[model samples]
Target chain A: MAASTLRYGRLRVVSAVAVIGFLLTSCGGSSDASDEVRVSAASSLSLAFAALGSAFEALNPGVDVVLNIGGSSLLREQILEGAPVDVYASASTDTMAPIVDGGLSDGNATVFVRGFLAIAVPAGNPAHVTGLDDFGNEELLIGLCDVVVPCGAYARQVMSRAGVEPAVDTNEPNVRSLLTKIEAGELDAGIVYMTDVRSASGGVEGIEIPDAVNVAADYPIAVIVEGPNTVGGRAFVDFVMSGVGQEILAGFGFVTP
Target chain B: MSRAQSSHGPSRPPIAFVVLAAIAVVFFLLPLIGLLARTPWSDLVSLLASEVVADALVLSAIASFAAVTISTVVGVPLAWVLARVDFRGRALVRGLVLLPLVLPPVVGGAALLFALGRRGVVGEPLYEATGLVLPFSIWGVVIAVTFVSMPFLVLTVEGALRNVDVRFEGAAASLGAGGWTVFRRVTLPMIGPSLAAGMVLTWARAIGEFGATVTFAGNLAGETQTLPLAVFVALETNRDTATALSLLMVAISLTVLVLLRDRWLRPQ
Candidate 1:
């Protein structure tokens, strides 16, 4: 019995070590490279920043640009929790406030671009949604971003300015998720950025919210103070504010700030 | 129950085993310690009393209890059929039933949406016939939770049914008891402990369901949002409120487990 027990113990230890070795190898990728610049950008900037990242990499050889795209508020929370992010770009200045207040940014965030809210509906406009006034129609299934998110805040502003009380069915976490539901026909209409409607490439149709009631969400970018590659971070932020970056933003239907 | 019985059972575990076990215990304890350390003690009462928390609690209770009731109604019969009835492709049927247990809840939610959403294959006809939309409603929350939780009940009860002695049931039937009476008098009593365990586990899983509920049901306060969804939204907007909610869930779960320790944790 003792002999068998000892053999079992030896086998268990060997397997444990093998498992640990496997995990270490799988997790040890690009983390030790000092030339990598990690940028966390808002999901709304996905297309614009993908182009920007490639352009920045082309200009700076041996410097890899990695992009982490998510909701602006979520990214801010992660940065506050000490995520190793070199650059941060948000869809709204409100989300950047926490980073600035926490002293996590190297300097004040600069407004890079602006986005306008529009009513997004599935192709063919199944609900026959015409304007912001339709948002108050309880008959249609409408979605909006959560109140805390920038797009949601802008949408709420636009609705209030128009004096339309929207019968919101669901509050998605971000603009992209809301757009997805609209595209899927799960939602009849949603409040999303003009850029998102463009990004959908006919999967959805956009009903323009009159400029008189629309709110332009200011996009901000900042370099992290404690990021490992502050130089690269600053360069990326500068590139975003440069003429080329403005062109890319314009191409994606954003208003250059 | 005595030291002498434990001494005769086996020799002391190997030192490596004891060390690894200790590490495992610490791994589980550390997270609880962190949660307790960060919990907002002073604001907890007020936070708990907030409208968001109150709505979420009531919704969670309604959805989870509804889920348990539905699971018990359908899952027990399925478990019995799987354990007692032999048929072609039984293994395939069983695998289909257990798929949600292994699939990510998000994937499960997406699948549910594809099948039940407004534009879904059957949903379109169903909606046209009745004008009954499921998503973003309380019914959606219950359905999402039930889809993810029923597998636990089915697996638990099936295992118990398989272990139950068929002779006792046969004897009861031979004494002129009907099939249903035999099952109720003999088979059910034999697996009573496991049935209770399965119901408790189903309730726990239903309450903690997040990914599927959010993805399929969508987040709407006082309608589809449950405790887990409320906790997630709070995490992004208010950390203190999120911590307070987390502590509340932990306390409630621990109390339930402790209160029912003898029913399922120990075997007679």
Candidate 2:
């Protein structure tokens, strides 16, 4: 009887341990200091932000920066969904305006750098696309960023300004996708940020638009109100708007806002 | 009364089955009902009529069908070998076959890129020999879809093959049936429902495939943009377009399930 009782006690202990293990595995996950800081930024700011992130990490002793690049709309959704993000930057005032209005962010957003939309052609200027008017060629395959993105909004601004109804073969999700098409020679021309052209590294050539059609892109950033690391978040945001940030942004060919 | 006896019985199989079925029905049907509920029916016809949406639908259907066909062709032979043949490292091969499913779809895409990109190992020779570039094209979509989806076909068909009687094959051989003939006439006929079910699963998986296709095929509209990719692109900027596209995907998937229900879920 004592042996049987011991056996039952042992079984209870085993089940208890298993339950604790299961709970620990499923719930109460690990938290430790790591180099990575998750930054959710708009897709249009990917090039500029990546360069800035690398430079920021270089100056900082141990902290590393990782950029989660996607549509500003999507990033907003993620932030709303309680993703573990430290910094949020967007491509447009319109996109950023909503985040600010929703009271989900702390501190007012500041525009650090500005970019203008330009027509990007394949390397060596294969299409010899001279100006925005060059996009009117029906034979040339033009890719545009979809209208929801800041880049797309800029492109539409330029097209409407020029009063040209150019044929668009594809509407990509981000500026990088448009750049990829231009680089592949699949698209004769695309509209992307001037900074993106610098990042492309000769994969595509940028054709500046006339002032009349050129629409400036503003980059806005804010800290999440409910972030676990508000200190790190605010520090990162300050570093981005600092002279160091300006240098990094300029190195990527961004004009000051 | 008969009802009282049934209810009071110790083993209430019918009642248990009813509860399980109710749970299953709610599990699958609720999400679809949610989609229908959220659908902007007022704008449905116009959204469907758009050329971009039409192109994506057609492309998705074609690519998914092609993916399922290729998976079926390759997976069946691989399944037969796995189930029937005794070979060295058979367990290793089985593990490798399941590698893609276990892998994150994005990683699988990157692996495909390394193997088949313009600067890839096989791609360099392939370009020189046949002037064929595997990445950034429609065929690349097929290859990506096939890579991630073949395991479903293989696992299902392999399970069916294992349960089939080997004595039938031995009898067919004694009756002067060649190996190929016996497989075609005897084995295939037995596993026909299994193959059908596997193909349906494969088709559904391919339709929903997004990561590998986007990475390998580069998401050029009318080229590599399947419905999922198109919906992703739409969701980036336009919430309405994304919702409309998602509703369409839900509708078609449900239609396929209903049409193929008996074949998909019938007991062997």
Cα displacement (angstroms), candidate 2, residue A8, comes to 34
Q: For model 2 chain A, where is the 10-residue window of minimal lDDT?
A: A2-11
TM per prediction:
0.88, 0.74
What DockQ results for candidate 2? 0.15
lDDT of 1 by residue, A202-224 (tens): 88999999989989999999999
Residue A116, candidate 1: how far off, in angstroms?
A: 0.9
Q: Of the candidates shown, which would achieve the greatest lDDT relative to the real structure? A: 1
- Candidate 2, clashing residue pairs? none
Off by over 4 Å in 1: A1-31, A57-64, B1-11, B165-178
**Model 2 lDDT tens row, B121-178:** 7765786789776765688888998898787788777776776777888899999999
Candidates' DockQ values?
A: 0.28, 0.15
Candidate 2, residues A1-257: lDDT per residue as tens digits? 32233333333433443353345335445354655677898876777788888888888878877788987777877787687787899888887886788787896888877888878888887667888777778766677887877788889889999988877756666776667657755567889888787778777888888887789888888988876666777888999889888888788788877
**Candidate that scores best on TM-score:** 1
